[model samples]
Target: MRKHCCTPGQTTRTPSGTKRPSVTGSFPADPILPEMVSLAGGEFLMGSAEPHAYPLDGEGPVRTESVPPYAVAATTVTVAQFDLFVTATGYLTDAERFGDSLVFEAALPHDARAHPRVAETPWWAIVGGADWRHPAGPDAEVDAVRDLADHPVVHVSRTDAEAFCRWSGTALPSEAQWEFASRGGLSQQPYPWGYERDPGGEARMNIWRGEFPGAVSTPTGKTFTAPARSYPPNGFGLFNTTGNVWEWTTGVFDQRRRDHRAVIRGGSHLCHESYCRRYRTSARSGTTPDSSSGHIGFRVITAK
Candidate 1:
């Protein structure tokens, strides 16, 4: 078995001058392939100043941000959609090229072990053969998950997402654009719906329902990602903007950092208020460009 390791803050880098994968197929020019929702963008306050915010994340000192009118996909790029890209471009994802990706320990196979654990975040395991195709491990396939084709594609790196965007004639949303859309026309609201995390005593998004890294108490009975549109759309008709998977953004996560990390907004099903607490529109995290994990995915937007 091949072994690969990286520190908590570092990522496995692909060497320069590597040839691009050969194209095996192509996708038709269908303008309506990805249903997009038009947003009449305007100025809004960005970031957070809440007392509960994580200072190190730079989610404070909120400032006004403006976005031009644009159209964003109503939902994240799904596995089936990504598959179409892969088929058209024959593109090898970073996870595939690197031979591994990070997997949540909870999703690992029962007998799977002997993997490197991230020192700072032990919940993540570097499992060989863990890629978009095999999200959990070598033994697990994405098809095993019912309706996975409609679920947000995870285990994708920023580079992979960019390639998909380029192929589809779209671009990754900026941090401001992503936040603006996630808010669903609400200003400074903690969640997409409103101030309440679970309005009407019901789950409005996909997130950790009970204990973190252990017990799951979701009222929806879903321990992992729910299908796209499983939950109600935000006021803007965008789905799963706050939870399900962290969406990549074009904004730099930290200018002081040298690893070229980009901002990832929203949060995943692993997010828990007691732990990550990043499932809000204002929350943000940084990950290296080449990093691929089960919780990270992305959506695309086109300028109007």
Candidate 2:
């Protein structure tokens, strides 16, 4: 298993090599928007004090954090929603420009499994033709995205998310805002639903129930990304805030660096207790702005 399974970041060729398509001036007169959950944000304790928390990723030293009231989407941006943005803007994602992106070893087609894998993290394969539209690879399916329309759009970079925000008149949530909203009305609970991972023997969120890098599936036999609304909503009426897919945030992981990594909240279907146990409200990891993967996505936010 990868040493830092939850904080996987792949170094790719520079995105500046190819010219990006210019986005058109205006958004659609009537755009499809996600259901927004309004949060009257206040001071909330952020970070984990649990022994399982990762220290290098900065998941500890819980502190009092606050954010002004804001509205966030009830679900992560779905493939159907992202399709509308690409159709309107003609914008190419960083993955498309780079000609390849990372795919989970298990997610790749058996034939395509021979693709070059990432160093140190052998579970991640650098597959050509793998992007938001074709997460697994070109040969996996002809109309892969259309079939998974309701699933959270994966293989999107922070730049791609910001572009969508620009076109949709929305913004990515800050770390503070995301944490505040993710907590719902509860105080410092590991999960948005409550303390126990599964209460009453019912799975509250979609996460890996089996072994890491070897086996992965939800309780309902979901192998990959589940629908954005597959799970219950938190106290703030936000769905899948702690699992399904890691959502991008606007804040830099290390503000001191000129080229800083962006923070990603929530864990995905790949998260497991033995390895990547980041399926909680306060858990976070960082990756480059241009990094895109099959498990990474983003949601939009609006300030009140």
Candidate 3:
């Protein structure tokens, strides 16, 4: 099976050395709340050694990874938090600037018109007017789910994530920092919590509980993104580190590849054991820097 993050498709590669947007806005006067957890970084085996691991995705060999002490968000950035940034800076997200974004076909209305699909992943549709605010399409209103403001923000690109990081006075975690933190001080474990996906028949994460690209059987009744704290946190007090949404990291997908794709970790609500088993701590995928989709978001870290 071909390895894919979530929305798999070809993207126009950007030239190297393109300057990222400069940081703007004055720092918040009040100290941001202690929503971040400080980790005493150390060495741990990174990647997977399972026979079923996808070799092409480079999810194996179980090499040791070391990271310095740092702090990471206890949860992914939420819609409310992002909204504040937008309101303050009037920043336009990549999806907003592009006028559309990739949405999971399942999220659209049944009567929605057929949109162009990614050749490799037909479940993804290019929905016009789809962005962080209009997650489904033009007709959907974010106010409908205003109660879910604590849920992780979606339809954001690397550029948008970087901008958030800049404004927040934090930075995107490096791949090593992400993996090391996600491991939760565990060594060579498949997941952050433990060896089993669910310990004692309880779901530890918010991954697909049913057939992928079709039905959702999550007992929690959460079909798409759940509240950031929907499930129990890992050993490091981090929530949704394995699933919920694939998170952007500062690492490149592959140093050898010439494309501008960046590394994305965790999985998403769409991931299932039958296919797209990327919810493990070491599992990884990539997307173009400019690409934005409903299943991709990010977290930030502050180095100590």
Candidate 4:
């Protein structure tokens, strides 16, 4: 794995002649045709300066952060691609080694009991065989999962994600890279499409529609894990960059605070405005990089 060595307290380092991977160096671009977007190097706004932006989370105090141009993957790694990595490398995801993975308890059938689940979130249950292949626990089968091959793979940890990137000759995007790509060159809009909830009354991203955790049967779209290319691509030709799943970034959760969690950007389908409105592009949440959950997976990045 290519390591980026930098001391603590420093936010970023100057671009160097150190070798970096090309956008499509490892894999052929036929299946993953990512567009190379130009993020004109300059100082742009970061964080929300509007109401309901949640001031306490350190999301704001909109600051000017300048980032050099770079290339990023168009979408999260798909099941077919991730499967290829596992087959070639004989890789074992953290969840697979741990014997259990975090699954949303509400994802269970209506007849399921709520008491036997883990305590913190009654909706989160630790199922013994909930690895990427078995996302819904032991009984859930992928054979019936529509488009299982092309859908973005979930139930992967940072370690698992980084390993896959290494095998692919790519790297995880830094948190800055993720935010910049997600913005799609638009001014700090609340949502990826814009600062509106389906502004024209059309769903731009696939997120929790009805009540959160439970009752998430999408009126039209929510069967489960939409195809990796199901939605409209962003300005950078990135798909599902805002909602389907949370993508892990290389940045720390808080380079400022004492928080021990690593940063995970772009929310998951399980997030609801009522509970977790992390679906916004600039919005961020974190968890232990070592922690693997069903909604947590990542996309890869290559050096520009």
TM, every model: 0.90, 0.93, 0.91, 0.83
Models ranked on lDDT: 2, 3, 1, 4
The number of the candidate with the highest TM-score is 2
Over 8-35, each residue of candidate 3 has an lDDT whose tens digit, in order, gives 6437423243343456764465433228
- Total clashing pairs for each candidate: 0, 0, 0, 1
Give the lowest summed-lDDT range of ten residues in model 1: 1-10
Instruction: Please say which candidate is ahead in lDDT: 2 or 4.
Output: 2
Candidate 4 TM-score to native: 0.83
**What is the C-alpha local distance difference test score of candidate 2?**
0.82
**lDDT by residue for model 2 (1-304), tens:** 2255755676647654777676645446554558887878888888888766777677778999878988899999999888888887788998999888888887776677689877777888888889988988886862445778888999999989998998787899998888888888888789997788889989888788876667545653423888888877888888899888999998787778676889999998888898788888888888888898988999889989
lDDT of 1 at 89: 76
Model 2 regions lying over 4 Å from their true place: 24-31, 219-223, 256-259
Q: Please write out the lDDT profile of model 4 over residues 1-304, one tens digit for every residue.
A: 2111100111121223333232222544555433344455455688876765656555788888877766677778877788777756677777776676776765554443332454445567666767788777766544313447677788787878888877677778887778878887778887766788587788877677886555655432433667677677776677888777789898776667675667888887776676677778777776766676667668776655
Models, CA RMSD each: 4.5, 2.2, 3.3, 8.6
Off by over 4 Å in 1: 1-10, 13-18, 22-32, 141-147, 216-223
What is the TM-score of candidate 1? 0.90
Off by over 4 Å in 4: 1-41, 109-116, 143-147, 219-223, 255-259
lDDT of 1: 0.79
Top candidate (lDDT): 2
